[model samples]
Target: MRGRKELEKYWGRPYTDTRDWSIYNERLVRRGEFYLSLDFIDHWTDLVSRMNTGKPGRPFHYPEPFITWMAFIHVFLQMPYRQMEGFTRKLSIFIPSLVSADYTTLFRRIKRLDISLRVDPTILSRNVIIAVDSTGIKVTNRGEWMREKWRVRRGWIKVHAMIDIETNQILGLEVTDESVQDDARCIPLLDQVQQHCGREHTIRRLLADGAYDRNEIFNTLEKRGILSGIKTRTDAATRSTGSPYRAECVRERVRLGGYREWAQDIDYGMRWKAEGVFSSGKRIFGETVRATSKEGMIREVKMKMNCYNMLLTMVK
Candidate 1:
């Protein structure tokens, strides 16, 4: 065993970080440009014309894209609406044709905005594996002060998401109150994955931690013909508790000696991509929701995720 270890060490090459720091740094710098982007202004008139063509109420003075850009700037830069309004008014000083939305307009338009994930077209042509997980974003950032002064409990909302392991793009997202369980979201997330990937694509597998270990989850995946790489509970039994597939999974893990061996066989390490995504999202967007209302908070989270996906594409 000692000789084998020495031979393995001699033959194996330790992986090195070969990333191009300059290009990566450049991409990060470009993120700032999105916050201040004026390219949308070129098509501003046409967008408004189409938007106002047959509308019932008063025609929109500011285009939806411009409103969306303001919203994006707000979330990405963590700037308040009033500050965003000031920023836009400042921009209009240089570009005489620019029309700025005030804080109230910004707030109303952002809440009413319909945000959706912009998935890559290539995902439709290939079989995919997905990792599923959820994380909590604070409902309000006043937790410390509120707790100290008012003795009130500050709550959080859950952001449940599924990502393509190959592309590291979010396939589906569901925003719920923190009371929603991880296992309960699996099927809905799977449905959303299908919606984004379309009828032609196949989900080859799913990877998740033991938080998703449940008979219903296993059976749902089994029916869809997708391999489940969800880690079973430590004391999982081979005996069927309702789902034979779950029993079989437990048996397979037992046969492989332990979780580590099973993980190797299934390449379960890829599940960390979900966690990495959550970390990246939190780092970029912060852990708190800026909106106080439930509806506004939901829209805010969705918009941030949409921006997150856009940022991912930019880096690629």
Candidate 2:
């Protein structure tokens, strides 16, 4: 892959928008107002909030629905607690619920929220092909200036995501520290799909990579009657390991000349869609997490995913 400097020529250095902005100025301005137009976005945040009922003690200042909405804004804007607190404070007059909000309140609400991202209904209506992959998210967002000034390097957290190929929407997600292996996440992601889609939902295919080539992983998919388009590593034990299902996958690749041909035959190249998911995530939300503690790290990543689903729902 080309580094940023090397890729500069491809970006058309002296860039300009070819489209006429004058014709679309009003529409573009209205589009940017989506965030300020709370009523327009309320439907999305309400769905997640309504799932959890309010507590049974002396009442809280803000309802769960309001808490849920504000928390999501934190992720959507990729803002820190202080920035989020200030943002809502400015809007306090427009929204009565924001009058009492503070950074700690927003923090606590997200920490406790039990997040579940549903498969889009249209995607659910038909069979699914899910792509599974993982990527590293850094602990801090340091631009070139900061890196050069401080010579700083930070640790990363791994995000395992399952994307519904057709919808191009994340169906489920898991986050862990950098030490966790990619293979460890495969089964958990599959289980999440089963939970969301139910027995009636047919999972037609599974796409993954060489890291998930273990025996149990293949067998698990076999039991579900899913055809796996996992790119297998070439090895002599290809004949000896696991069940015929696994061996057949390898043999088929060997027979088709090589990995390239096998991929083209089965549309295995679509596995890169999972990679595209990670790239889009990092590009939209920045490639780092702001949380310091383990639990906080997990919660922050999960909130980003929940925000992704909400954005997908709203756009669709």
Which one wins on lDDT?
1
- Candidate 2 versus the native: TM-score? 0.79
Total backbone collisions, model 1:
0
lDDT of 2 by residue, 260-310 (tens): 778778877678888987887777677878787877777878877776665
Record all residue pairs in model 2 with backbone atoms less than 3 Å apart, i.e. clashing. Answer: none
Candidate 1, residues 108-214, lDDT tens digits: the string is 88778888777774644478889999999987777587678988776789999998877789999999998999999889999989888876788999999888998
The backbone clash count of each candidate, in order, is 0, 0
Question: Which 10-residue window in model 2 sums to the lowest lDDT?
Answer: 40-49
> CA shift at 267, candidate 2, in angstroms?
0.4
Off by over 4 Å in 1: 1-23, 123-125, 143-150
Looking at candidate 2, what is the lDDT of residue 65? Answer: 62
